[model samples]
Target: MLQFKLVLLGDSSVGKSSIVHRFVKDSFDELRESTIGAAFLSQTIKIKAEEQEEDVVIKFEIWDTAGQERYKSLAPMYYRNANAALVVYDLTQKDSLVKARSWVEELKNKVGDEDLVIFLVGNKLDLCEGEEDLRAVDTSEAKAYAEEQNLLFTEVSAKTGQGVKEVFRSIGEKLYASKKDEILAKKNRELGNRVNNSVDINAQRPSTNDTTTCCS
Candidate 1:
Protein backbone atom coordinates (compact mmCIF):
# COMPACT_ATOMS: atom_id res chain seq x y z
CA MET A 1 0.00 0.00 0.00
CA LEU A 2 1.29 3.44 -0.93
CA GLN A 3 0.15 6.75 0.52
CA PHE A 4 0.05 10.10 -1.25
CA LYS A 5 -0.54 13.59 0.03
CA LEU A 6 -3.25 15.41 -1.92
CA VAL A 7 -4.25 19.03 -1.45
CA LEU A 8 -7.10 21.25 -2.67
CA LEU A 9 -6.72 24.97 -3.39
CA GLY A 10 -9.15 27.62 -4.62
CA ASP A 11 -11.11 30.66 -3.55
CA SER A 12 -13.58 30.36 -0.73
CA SER A 13 -17.02 28.83 -1.46
CA VAL A 14 -15.88 27.31 -4.72
CA GLY A 15 -17.03 23.91 -3.39
CA LYS A 16 -13.57 22.65 -2.48
CA SER A 17 -15.02 20.98 0.59
CA SER A 18 -17.97 19.76 -1.39
CA ILE A 19 -15.75 18.11 -3.96
CA VAL A 20 -13.66 16.41 -1.30
CA HIS A 21 -16.75 15.31 0.58
CA ARG A 22 -18.43 13.96 -2.51
CA PHE A 23 -15.36 11.96 -3.41
CA VAL A 24 -14.65 10.68 0.09
CA LYS A 25 -18.17 10.16 1.41
CA ASP A 26 -20.25 9.98 -1.79
CA SER A 27 -22.54 12.64 -0.32
CA PHE A 28 -23.19 16.31 -0.95
CA ASP A 29 -24.46 19.09 1.26
CA GLU A 30 -26.39 22.06 -0.05
CA LEU A 31 -25.39 24.23 2.89
CA ARG A 32 -21.90 22.95 3.46
CA GLU A 33 -20.08 25.13 5.97
CA SER A 34 -16.94 27.01 5.15
CA THR A 35 -13.69 25.30 6.02
CA ILE A 36 -11.45 27.05 8.51
CA GLY A 37 -7.69 26.63 8.04
CA ALA A 38 -7.84 23.08 6.57
CA ALA A 39 -9.75 19.87 6.83
CA PHE A 40 -8.10 16.45 6.77
CA LEU A 41 -9.57 13.36 5.18
CA SER A 42 -8.36 10.04 3.84
CA GLN A 43 -9.64 7.59 1.26
CA THR A 44 -8.16 4.44 -0.27
CA ILE A 45 -8.50 3.58 -3.93
CA LYS A 46 -7.38 0.47 -5.79
CA ILE A 47 -5.81 1.03 -9.19
CA LYS A 48 -5.55 -1.92 -11.55
CA ALA A 49 -2.96 -1.95 -14.29
CA GLU A 50 -4.15 -2.80 -17.78
CA GLU A 51 -1.00 -4.71 -18.66
CA GLN A 52 -0.24 -6.20 -15.28
CA GLU A 53 -2.01 -8.67 -13.00
CA GLU A 54 -1.39 -6.78 -9.77
CA ASP A 55 -3.47 -3.95 -8.39
CA VAL A 56 -2.01 -0.95 -6.56
CA VAL A 57 -3.64 0.33 -3.40
CA ILE A 58 -3.29 4.09 -2.99
CA LYS A 59 -4.19 5.87 0.22
CA PHE A 60 -4.72 9.58 -0.21
CA GLU A 61 -4.16 11.93 2.69
CA ILE A 62 -6.35 14.79 1.54
CA TRP A 63 -6.01 18.32 2.88
CA ASP A 64 -8.99 20.47 2.01
CA THR A 65 -7.42 23.86 2.60
CA ALA A 66 -9.33 26.99 3.47
CA GLY A 67 -9.56 29.12 0.36
CA GLN A 68 -9.98 32.54 1.97
CA GLU A 69 -7.42 35.19 1.11
CA ARG A 70 -6.45 35.36 4.78
CA TYR A 71 -5.44 31.73 4.72
CA LYS A 72 -3.44 32.09 1.55
CA SER A 73 -0.13 32.40 3.33
CA LEU A 74 -0.65 29.13 5.17
CA ALA A 75 -1.30 27.09 2.05
CA PRO A 76 2.33 26.12 1.47
CA MET A 77 2.42 24.25 4.74
CA TYR A 78 -0.41 21.99 3.65
CA TYR A 79 0.78 21.45 0.12
CA ARG A 80 4.49 21.21 0.92
CA ASN A 81 4.86 17.52 0.09
CA ALA A 82 1.69 17.01 -1.88
CA ASN A 83 1.91 14.44 -4.64
CA ALA A 84 -1.16 15.82 -6.43
CA ALA A 85 -3.23 19.01 -6.28
CA LEU A 86 -6.69 20.10 -7.44
CA VAL A 87 -6.91 23.81 -8.17
CA VAL A 88 -10.69 24.30 -8.29
CA TYR A 89 -12.74 27.17 -9.65
CA ASP A 90 -16.43 27.87 -9.92
CA LEU A 91 -17.70 27.80 -13.50
CA THR A 92 -20.32 30.46 -12.74
CA GLN A 93 -17.70 32.90 -11.46
CA LYS A 94 -15.10 34.06 -13.94
CA ASP A 95 -13.07 35.62 -11.16
CA SER A 96 -12.77 32.23 -9.49
CA LEU A 97 -10.97 30.98 -12.55
CA VAL A 98 -8.63 33.92 -12.34
CA LYS A 99 -7.96 33.03 -8.75
CA ALA A 100 -7.45 29.43 -9.81
CA ARG A 101 -4.78 30.55 -12.24
CA SER A 102 -3.05 32.48 -9.50
CA TRP A 103 -3.11 29.39 -7.33
CA VAL A 104 -1.57 27.38 -10.13
CA GLU A 105 1.17 29.94 -10.55
CA GLU A 106 1.88 29.94 -6.84
CA LEU A 107 2.13 26.18 -6.84
CA LYS A 108 4.58 26.17 -9.68
CA ASN A 109 6.79 28.93 -8.27
CA LYS A 110 6.67 27.88 -4.64
CA VAL A 111 6.23 24.13 -4.75
CA GLY A 112 8.86 24.02 -7.47
CA ASP A 113 8.49 20.36 -8.32
CA GLU A 114 8.19 19.12 -11.88
CA ASP A 115 6.67 15.82 -10.77
CA LEU A 116 3.64 17.40 -9.06
CA VAL A 117 0.39 16.37 -10.72
CA ILE A 118 -2.05 19.27 -10.88
CA PHE A 119 -5.62 19.46 -12.19
CA LEU A 120 -7.40 22.67 -13.12
CA VAL A 121 -10.92 21.78 -12.06
CA GLY A 122 -13.93 23.89 -12.95
CA ASN A 123 -16.62 23.14 -10.41
CA LYS A 124 -20.40 23.94 -10.36
CA LEU A 125 -21.19 22.37 -13.70
CA ASP A 126 -24.61 21.62 -12.31
CA LEU A 127 -25.31 25.32 -12.31
CA CYS A 128 -24.67 25.53 -16.03
CA GLU A 129 -26.44 22.36 -17.22
CA GLY A 130 -29.62 23.71 -18.78
CA GLU A 131 -28.81 27.37 -18.33
CA GLU A 132 -25.49 27.58 -20.09
CA ASP A 133 -25.75 31.32 -19.68
CA LEU A 134 -24.74 30.92 -16.04
CA ARG A 135 -21.35 29.60 -16.96
CA ALA A 136 -18.88 32.45 -16.75
CA VAL A 137 -15.71 30.49 -17.37
CA ASP A 138 -15.26 29.10 -20.84
CA THR A 139 -14.21 25.46 -20.84
CA SER A 140 -11.98 25.86 -23.85
CA GLU A 141 -10.05 28.72 -22.31
CA ALA A 142 -9.43 26.86 -19.09
CA LYS A 143 -8.47 23.77 -21.06
CA ALA A 144 -6.07 25.73 -23.22
CA TYR A 145 -4.31 27.20 -20.20
CA ALA A 146 -4.17 23.77 -18.61
CA GLU A 147 -2.55 22.39 -21.69
CA GLU A 148 -0.07 25.25 -21.80
CA GLN A 149 0.82 24.69 -18.17
CA ASN A 150 0.78 20.90 -18.35
CA LEU A 151 -2.18 20.44 -16.05
CA LEU A 152 -4.99 17.95 -16.09
CA PHE A 153 -8.25 19.76 -16.87
CA THR A 154 -11.86 18.79 -16.15
CA GLU A 155 -15.20 20.22 -15.09
CA VAL A 156 -17.17 18.50 -12.35
CA SER A 157 -20.46 18.97 -10.53
CA ALA A 158 -20.39 17.94 -6.93
CA LYS A 159 -24.16 18.10 -6.57
CA THR A 160 -24.99 15.83 -9.51
CA GLY A 161 -21.86 13.66 -9.09
CA GLN A 162 -20.96 14.28 -12.73
CA GLY A 163 -17.24 13.85 -13.45
CA VAL A 164 -16.49 13.77 -9.71
CA LYS A 165 -15.36 10.17 -9.65
CA GLU A 166 -13.34 10.65 -12.79
CA VAL A 167 -11.34 13.47 -11.19
CA PHE A 168 -10.12 11.32 -8.30
CA ARG A 169 -9.68 8.31 -10.53
CA SER A 170 -7.47 10.30 -12.86
CA ILE A 171 -5.37 11.46 -9.96
CA GLY A 172 -5.08 7.91 -8.68
CA GLU A 173 -4.01 6.66 -12.07
CA LYS A 174 -1.31 9.30 -12.40
CA LEU A 175 -0.01 8.69 -8.91
CA TYR A 176 0.03 4.93 -9.48
CA ALA A 177 1.88 5.33 -12.75
CA SER A 178 4.45 7.62 -11.16
CA LYS A 179 4.97 5.22 -8.29
CA LYS A 180 5.41 2.33 -10.69
CA ASP A 181 7.97 4.26 -12.66
CA GLU A 182 9.86 5.15 -9.49
CA ILE A 183 9.91 1.53 -8.35
CA LEU A 184 11.12 0.37 -11.73
CA ALA A 185 13.87 2.94 -11.77
CA LYS A 186 14.98 1.86 -8.31
CA LYS A 187 15.05 -1.80 -9.35
CA ASN A 188 17.07 -0.95 -12.42
CA ARG A 189 19.61 0.91 -10.33
CA GLU A 190 19.87 -2.01 -7.93
CA LEU A 191 20.39 -4.44 -10.80
CA GLY A 192 23.06 -2.22 -12.30
CA ASN A 193 24.88 -2.00 -8.98
CA ARG A 194 24.73 -5.78 -8.53
CA VAL A 195 26.13 -6.38 -12.00
CA ASN A 196 28.93 -3.90 -11.39
CA ASN A 197 29.75 -5.55 -8.05
CA SER A 198 29.80 -8.98 -9.69
CA VAL A 199 32.18 -7.71 -12.35
CA ASP A 200 34.45 -6.19 -9.68
CA ILE A 201 34.52 -9.48 -7.78
CA ASN A 202 35.38 -11.43 -10.92
CA ALA A 203 38.15 -8.97 -11.76
CA GLN A 204 39.61 -9.23 -8.24
CA ARG A 205 39.42 -13.08 -8.01
CA PRO A 206 42.27 -15.31 -9.30
CA SER A 207 41.32 -17.43 -12.36
CA THR A 208 41.44 -21.23 -11.99
CA ASN A 209 44.28 -21.40 -14.52
CA ASP A 210 46.25 -18.83 -12.49
CA THR A 211 45.66 -20.46 -9.08
CA THR A 212 48.68 -21.89 -7.24
CA THR A 213 48.93 -25.66 -6.72
CA CYS A 214 48.93 -25.78 -2.92
CA CYS A 215 49.88 -29.55 -2.50
CA SER A 216 51.99 -30.02 -5.64
Candidate 2:
Protein backbone atom coordinates (compact mmCIF):
# COMPACT_ATOMS: atom_id res chain seq x y z
CA MET A 1 0.00 0.00 0.00
CA LEU A 2 1.17 3.51 -0.72
CA GLN A 3 1.00 5.75 2.31
CA PHE A 4 0.79 9.51 2.55
CA LYS A 5 0.45 12.04 5.31
CA LEU A 6 -2.69 14.19 5.22
CA VAL A 7 -3.42 17.18 7.44
CA LEU A 8 -6.58 19.06 8.37
CA LEU A 9 -6.55 22.79 9.07
CA GLY A 10 -9.17 25.40 9.85
CA ASP A 11 -10.49 27.67 12.58
CA SER A 12 -11.81 26.27 15.86
CA SER A 13 -15.17 24.47 15.66
CA VAL A 14 -15.16 24.29 11.90
CA GLY A 15 -15.79 20.54 12.31
CA LYS A 16 -12.33 19.34 11.31
CA SER A 17 -12.44 16.57 13.90
CA SER A 18 -16.02 15.78 12.94
CA ILE A 19 -14.95 15.44 9.34
CA VAL A 20 -12.16 13.05 10.33
CA HIS A 21 -14.43 10.97 12.52
CA ARG A 22 -17.09 10.87 9.84
CA PHE A 23 -14.66 9.67 7.23
CA VAL A 24 -12.68 7.23 9.35
CA LYS A 25 -15.31 5.85 11.71
CA ASP A 26 -18.54 6.65 9.86
CA SER A 27 -19.78 8.32 13.07
CA PHE A 28 -20.45 11.83 14.31
CA ASP A 29 -20.28 13.58 17.66
CA GLU A 30 -22.40 16.62 18.27
CA LEU A 31 -20.41 17.84 21.24
CA ARG A 32 -16.92 16.96 20.09
CA GLU A 33 -14.40 18.96 22.05
CA SER A 34 -11.79 21.14 20.43
CA THR A 35 -8.51 19.44 19.52
CA ILE A 36 -5.70 20.23 21.96
CA GLY A 37 -2.58 20.07 19.78
CA ALA A 38 -3.12 17.43 17.13
CA ALA A 39 -4.62 14.02 16.72
CA PHE A 40 -3.39 11.20 14.48
CA LEU A 41 -5.59 8.74 12.66
CA SER A 42 -5.19 6.52 9.66
CA GLN A 43 -7.59 5.06 7.11
CA THR A 44 -7.01 3.06 3.98
CA ILE A 45 -9.14 3.55 0.86
CA LYS A 46 -9.07 1.75 -2.46
CA ILE A 47 -9.25 3.39 -5.86
CA LYS A 48 -10.52 1.27 -8.70
CA ALA A 49 -8.15 1.04 -11.59
CA GLU A 50 -9.30 0.70 -15.16
CA GLU A 51 -5.89 -0.45 -16.39
CA GLN A 52 -5.02 -2.83 -13.57
CA GLU A 53 -6.57 -5.95 -12.08
CA GLU A 54 -6.14 -4.93 -8.44
CA ASP A 55 -7.46 -1.76 -6.88
CA VAL A 56 -4.95 0.84 -5.77
CA VAL A 57 -4.68 0.99 -2.00
CA ILE A 58 -3.95 4.35 -0.41
CA LYS A 59 -3.34 4.72 3.30
CA PHE A 60 -3.75 8.21 4.64
CA GLU A 61 -1.84 8.99 7.85
CA ILE A 62 -4.06 11.84 8.94
CA TRP A 63 -3.07 14.62 11.31
CA ASP A 64 -6.07 16.50 12.66
CA THR A 65 -4.52 19.66 14.04
CA ALA A 66 -5.90 22.12 16.56
CA GLY A 67 -7.22 25.38 15.13
CA GLN A 68 -6.88 27.60 18.19
CA GLU A 69 -4.51 30.57 17.95
CA ARG A 70 -2.25 29.06 20.61
CA TYR A 71 -1.85 25.89 18.57
CA LYS A 72 -1.37 27.80 15.34
CA SER A 73 2.37 27.73 15.91
CA LEU A 74 2.32 23.93 16.01
CA ALA A 75 0.51 23.58 12.68
CA PRO A 76 3.71 23.88 10.69
CA MET A 77 5.11 20.81 12.41
CA TYR A 78 2.07 18.76 11.48
CA TYR A 79 1.76 19.98 7.92
CA ARG A 80 5.47 20.09 7.08
CA ASN A 81 5.65 17.00 4.88
CA ALA A 82 1.97 16.33 4.38
CA ASN A 83 1.07 14.90 1.00
CA ALA A 84 -2.43 16.36 1.03
CA ALA A 85 -4.48 18.74 3.16
CA LEU A 86 -8.10 19.64 3.78
CA VAL A 87 -8.79 23.24 4.73
CA VAL A 88 -12.26 23.15 6.21
CA TYR A 89 -14.68 26.00 7.04
CA ASP A 90 -18.22 26.30 8.26
CA LEU A 91 -20.72 27.41 5.65
CA THR A 92 -22.68 29.35 8.25
CA GLN A 93 -19.81 31.73 8.91
CA LYS A 94 -18.19 33.89 6.27
CA ASP A 95 -15.30 34.65 8.59
CA SER A 96 -14.53 30.97 8.77
CA LEU A 97 -14.00 30.97 5.06
CA VAL A 98 -11.63 33.91 5.43
CA LYS A 99 -9.70 31.93 8.03
CA ALA A 100 -9.70 28.93 5.72
CA ARG A 101 -8.14 31.08 3.01
CA SER A 102 -5.39 32.14 5.38
CA TRP A 103 -4.67 28.53 6.17
CA VAL A 104 -4.52 27.80 2.46
CA GLU A 105 -2.05 30.65 1.95
CA GLU A 106 0.07 29.44 4.81
CA LEU A 107 0.17 25.97 3.31
CA LYS A 108 1.19 27.20 -0.12
CA ASN A 109 3.85 29.47 1.35
CA LYS A 110 5.32 26.93 3.75
CA VAL A 111 4.74 23.62 2.02
CA GLY A 112 4.84 24.78 -1.58
CA ASP A 113 2.22 23.61 -4.12
CA GLU A 114 4.30 21.28 -6.25
CA ASP A 115 3.50 17.95 -4.60
CA LEU A 116 0.78 18.89 -2.13
CA VAL A 117 -2.89 18.29 -2.90
CA ILE A 118 -5.24 20.76 -1.20
CA PHE A 119 -9.02 20.75 -0.83
CA LEU A 120 -11.15 23.66 0.29
CA VAL A 121 -14.03 22.08 2.19
CA GLY A 122 -17.13 23.92 3.38
CA ASN A 123 -18.71 21.88 6.13
CA LYS A 124 -22.14 21.80 7.83
CA LEU A 125 -24.23 21.55 4.70
CA ASP A 126 -27.10 20.30 6.86
CA LEU A 127 -27.38 23.65 8.59
CA CYS A 128 -28.33 25.34 5.34
CA GLU A 129 -30.91 22.81 4.26
CA GLY A 130 -34.23 24.67 3.93
CA GLU A 131 -32.71 27.47 5.91
CA GLU A 132 -30.72 28.93 3.06
CA ASP A 133 -30.25 32.18 4.98
CA LEU A 134 -27.94 30.33 7.36
CA ARG A 135 -25.35 29.96 4.64
CA ALA A 136 -22.94 32.85 4.73
CA VAL A 137 -20.33 31.48 2.33
CA ASP A 138 -21.67 31.49 -1.19
CA THR A 139 -21.05 28.27 -3.06
CA SER A 140 -20.15 30.10 -6.23
CA GLU A 141 -17.72 32.35 -4.37
CA ALA A 142 -15.97 29.47 -2.66
CA LYS A 143 -15.84 27.44 -5.86
CA ALA A 144 -14.33 30.38 -7.69
CA TYR A 145 -11.63 30.80 -5.08
CA ALA A 146 -10.92 27.08 -5.23
CA GLU A 147 -10.51 27.23 -8.97
CA GLU A 148 -8.28 30.27 -8.80
CA GLN A 149 -6.10 28.52 -6.26
CA ASN A 150 -6.20 25.17 -8.09
CA LEU A 151 -7.78 23.26 -5.25
CA LEU A 152 -10.40 20.55 -5.06
CA PHE A 153 -13.59 21.99 -3.54
CA THR A 154 -16.67 20.49 -1.96
CA GLU A 155 -19.29 21.14 0.71
CA VAL A 156 -20.13 18.41 3.18
CA SER A 157 -22.37 17.79 6.20
CA ALA A 158 -20.44 15.87 8.82
CA LYS A 159 -23.51 15.29 10.95
CA THR A 160 -25.58 13.84 8.13
CA GLY A 161 -22.61 12.22 6.32
CA GLN A 162 -23.51 13.98 3.11
CA GLY A 163 -20.58 14.21 0.72
CA VAL A 164 -18.27 12.92 3.44
CA LYS A 165 -17.14 9.73 1.72
CA GLU A 166 -16.65 11.52 -1.55
CA VAL A 167 -14.13 13.89 0.02
CA PHE A 168 -11.65 11.14 1.00
CA ARG A 169 -12.47 9.08 -2.07
CA SER A 170 -11.53 11.96 -4.33
CA ILE A 171 -8.30 12.47 -2.41
CA GLY A 172 -7.39 8.82 -2.73
CA GLU A 173 -8.12 8.73 -6.42
CA LYS A 174 -6.19 11.90 -7.17
CA LEU A 175 -3.20 10.91 -5.10
CA TYR A 176 -3.07 7.47 -6.66
CA ALA A 177 -3.27 8.85 -10.17
CA SER A 178 -0.55 11.42 -9.52
CA LYS A 179 1.85 9.20 -7.57
CA LYS A 180 1.27 5.77 -9.09
CA ASP A 181 4.39 5.71 -11.20
CA GLU A 182 6.63 7.09 -8.50
CA ILE A 183 5.26 4.68 -5.93
CA LEU A 184 5.64 1.69 -8.23
CA ALA A 185 9.20 2.71 -9.09
CA LYS A 186 10.03 2.98 -5.41
CA LYS A 187 8.61 -0.47 -4.69
CA ASN A 188 10.50 -1.96 -7.58
CA ARG A 189 13.77 -0.49 -6.35
CA GLU A 190 13.20 -1.85 -2.87
CA LEU A 191 12.39 -5.27 -4.25
CA GLY A 192 15.52 -5.23 -6.36
CA ASN A 193 17.67 -4.31 -3.38
CA ARG A 194 16.19 -7.17 -1.35
CA VAL A 195 16.85 -9.64 -4.15
CA ASN A 196 20.43 -8.49 -4.50
CA ASN A 197 21.12 -8.73 -0.77
CA SER A 198 19.59 -12.22 -0.37
CA VAL A 199 22.11 -14.87 0.68
CA ASP A 200 22.16 -18.42 -0.75
CA ILE A 201 22.75 -20.61 2.28
CA ASN A 202 22.86 -23.77 0.18
CA ALA A 203 25.73 -22.38 -1.88
CA GLN A 204 27.78 -21.76 1.28
CA ARG A 205 27.59 -25.38 2.45
CA PRO A 206 30.54 -27.75 1.68
CA SER A 207 30.00 -29.39 -1.70
CA THR A 208 28.94 -33.10 -1.56
CA ASN A 209 31.10 -33.68 -4.68
CA ASP A 210 34.21 -33.35 -2.47
CA THR A 211 35.02 -37.07 -1.92
CA THR A 212 38.07 -36.51 0.37
CA THR A 213 37.68 -38.05 3.85
CA CYS A 214 38.01 -35.56 6.71
CA CYS A 215 39.28 -38.26 9.22
CA SER A 216 42.35 -39.11 7.04
Best by TM-score: 2
Cα RMSD of predicted structure 2: 10.5
What C-alpha lDDT do the candidate models reach, one value each? 0.87, 0.88
Question: Can you write out model 1's per-residue Cα lDDT over 57-152, one digit (the tens) per residue?
Answer: 677889999999888888999989899999999999989999999999999998977779999999999999774569988899999999999999
- lDDT (Cα) of model 1: 0.87
Show pairs that collide, candidate 1.
none
Report residue 169 deviation for candidate 1 (angstroms): 0.9
- Predicted candidate 2 versus true structure: per-residue lDDT over 75-167, tens digit per residue: 999899888999999999989999999999999999965879999999999999884558988999999999999999999999999998899
TM-score of each: 0.84, 0.85
- TM-score of model number 2: 0.85
